[model samples]
Target: MIKHIVKDTFILQRLSSVATENDSDIVKDLIDTLEANKEICAGMAANMIGINKRIIAFQDNGKITVMLNPEIIRMSDAYKTKEGCLSLEGQRETTRYRSIKVKYQDTNMKVKIKTYKDFTAQVIQHEIDHCNGILI
Candidate 1:
């Protein structure tokens, strides 16, 4: 099912249960929403489709990618970043890995791997944290 949780409510933003062979709809909904909303994410500098923690910024690269139930497979040394979450309303200090490699299922249920660093790392880590039930 596609569960769109309320932002800043915090409780609803948590690690999701692993998708079985059945959850194709949830994945599809997220992908459709994300792909359709790329322009708005760029315009606002942030996009929150489900929860603020799932919010991502569109890079100038002209693609909006959505990872369903993404998991971080690797992480680098810790670094501090001033973070902004749509749920939190403002920036806060959060220490997190400086780089990460994530594996997520695409809309078609094909697993995809992507590495992230710098600001991209920040956003990915934030989103991953949401998958783990942490709201910052």
Candidate 2:
């Protein structure tokens, strides 16, 4: 389980490495835990930014989405409407993005790349910025 740190105690450092052998198990466990938890919806919020993001794979078309502390290292010229975050009091601010390509490590410690477009990409970008200590 992740230790959800308080705002004052939150730190913005790179995440630690998970054991290679235990990655799948750990990610699965986390996915189950989060999915079972009624709060995963809100836990899906920026509150997870500083919190250790648990890796969870989406079952559709074998999409493995391990989003723990994922960051967007690059962005395109596209732009989208700002999304609201629970931690931010649900105020939309119009964050900018055209397209975004993100680099992240998955449960298997394998590097992964995902391309985002329009609003979806913006959400990812916003969440990534949150992981890097930018809030808005």
Best candidate per TM-score, number? 1
Supply every candidate's count of residue pairs whose N, Cα or C atoms clash at under 3 angstroms. 2, 4
Worst ten-residue run, lDDT, model 2?
A: 55-64
Please write out the lDDT profile of model 2 over residues 6-49, one tens digit for every residue: 34324433333323535555565545533544342322322342
Residues 19-100 of candidate 1 have per-residue lDDT tens digits of: 5446555445555554554443221111234533232323425665656557789998898777765445677898988788
Report the lDDT of model 2 for residue 123: 54
Residue pairs with backbone overlap in model 2:
78-97, 78-98, 79-97, 79-98
TM-score of each candidate structure, all chains considered together: 0.67, 0.57
Number of clashing residue pairs, candidate 2: 4
lDDT of 1: 0.57
Best by lDDT: 1
